[model samples]
Target: MSQPDSVTFADIEVAAKRLAGIAHHTPVITSRTINQHTGSQVFFKCKNFQRTGSFKFRGAYNALAQLRLEQQQTGAIAYSSGNHAQAVALAGQLLNIPTTIVMPEDAPTVKQAATRGYGAEVILYNRSETNREELAQTLAQQRNLTIIPPYDHPHIIAAQGTAAKELIKEVGELDLLLVCCGGGGLLSGSAIASQTLSPKCKVIGVEPERADDATRSFHSKILYSVNNPDTIADGARTPSLGKITFPLVLDYVDNMVTVSEEAIIRTMFFLWQRLKIVVEPTGVLAAAALLEGVVKAPQAKIGVVISGGNVDLKGLGHKIMNYEL
Candidate 1:
């Protein structure tokens, strides 16, 4: 198992301190009905309530905060499907550094608008024809900006580690930790923090069936890609495992699982109606995995991190009404 470079418990402890007032100490929420149905006590880390409405803010802000003075003045750029784009935009706005986001032209309009609303310049490219990495590279050369990747950097991972560290602090000794995976930043960081802080807790990553690259990669012991996903969980439509994140997940993650789009939509509806929480399809998929029996809930106390709440409401009703896997 290839682990992250010599990250000790003390490293995550330091990250928690640095991230103390910066990242929101999102609450651990529970529902009696969910607990009764699953036959397991559950603690939900509601990162949906985090700044920029996702856990990405924790890592993005942390990475930006650690940058050298020159790097801060030179500004930063990122390529994301949605949540990370908003994270970087908001981080840059607070740090007073210029930020540019290169995103798929077909990203959720709400997320794109939110990124722009933060005053970051938004660049859109065709998903099919233009490679975002190549475009970001070219832009970096021309504009001299640091490209803060969505999930593949250590500083970013350390920032993400703060969420799980806080969760363990609030609800001690969970038996299992579940997190939704797009490019694996949240899961990787959670794994590192969980292994170090709550060593006995088994960490699992959840994904939509249509965008199950992490699951495939874990099973094959090789990095995998699922470019051009057709899932409703648009936030998780990344094509592959990130370079830094892949090894971390392979080493520390206990397992990776998938849920159908139908299950995801059903869980989204349940969360909205029953939990009164507005979770995006990607965020709801971990609960959906449990609901669909893709994940056995016999592991005593299980913690699921609800990632983000950036769903598009305009066509949601129609999709949830007649959606299929």
Candidate 2:
């Protein structure tokens, strides 16, 4: 199938088939404690159990798998703060394609090590000083590598939708579906899937208060970008949504909400303590919104996408032990 700028529910279905047997059908988890606290029935789509420890693997693998044989032979390139880097690297290794990733120098050490451990050449740059996209493009051209962006492409969006598709399939139907938004890929994709599979579901995107470009854009109906925001949710520190994802979000997403950094940390701790799941900060965006009652639909059936589990264990432990954000 030829790639398009925008993705559809059919495209997401095709991606699901393509990923069959390759990607894990991650579990849908529930916490009675959480339900009691929020006064809602919540199902958590645990993408943290996904390969490469994040939902990013779904998109990365799908994109790379569709490349021309010649392109695969040449290699693939990507830029990410952490999870996407590891996703692309692991996908390339599985497909016997050389992969190169550009990551911020100050990215979580565990993520950096995991990306390199997946057999990809890791290039670190100062995020504040260098533009990662431009650097990745230059390297891709020089090395004849195909660029598989983190969340800007059709394949990525479609593949990411499979998470919600699986969630809805497992849980029947939901009144609301909450997703963590970074570049809007997962939110857009999930919106499309929910529109098809559960038309009554109101899709909501959640982000850190610091990285509220998506929230602003959703409200204003105009795309906006923000510089690097200092938030503990490193996975969601994206500057803005991409061209491909923006329109889908605007049309299909019902609402957008922002959670404070403290709310995010508190949610993460709750997940670890009550749910027995170690979700990263970004993964807790949706849960934070629900727990904080930022967007309330009392007694509603809700689905929350736990995006990833790539936490820096030592750092997270320290923060939790000391009640630090």
Residue 264 lDDT, candidate 1, scale 0-100: 91
- Score residue 240 of candidate 2 by CA lDDT: 97
Model 2 clash pairs are: none
**CA lDDT, every prediction?**
0.86, 0.93
Work out the TM-score per prediction.
0.95, 0.97
Best by lDDT: 2
Put down candidate 2 lDDT per residue, 172-251, tens digits, no spaces: 88999999999999999999999999999999999999999999999998999999888889999999999888888988
Question: In model 2, which range of ten residues has the least summed lDDT?
Answer: 316-325
Consecutive 10-residue window with the lowest summed lDDT within model 1: 1-10
Question: How well is each residue in 157-241 modelled by candidate 1, as lDDT tens digits?
Answer: 7778777888888989889888888888888888888997788999989998999999999989989998789898988888888
Residue 73 C-alpha lDDT in model 1: 98
lDDT of 1 at 321: 64
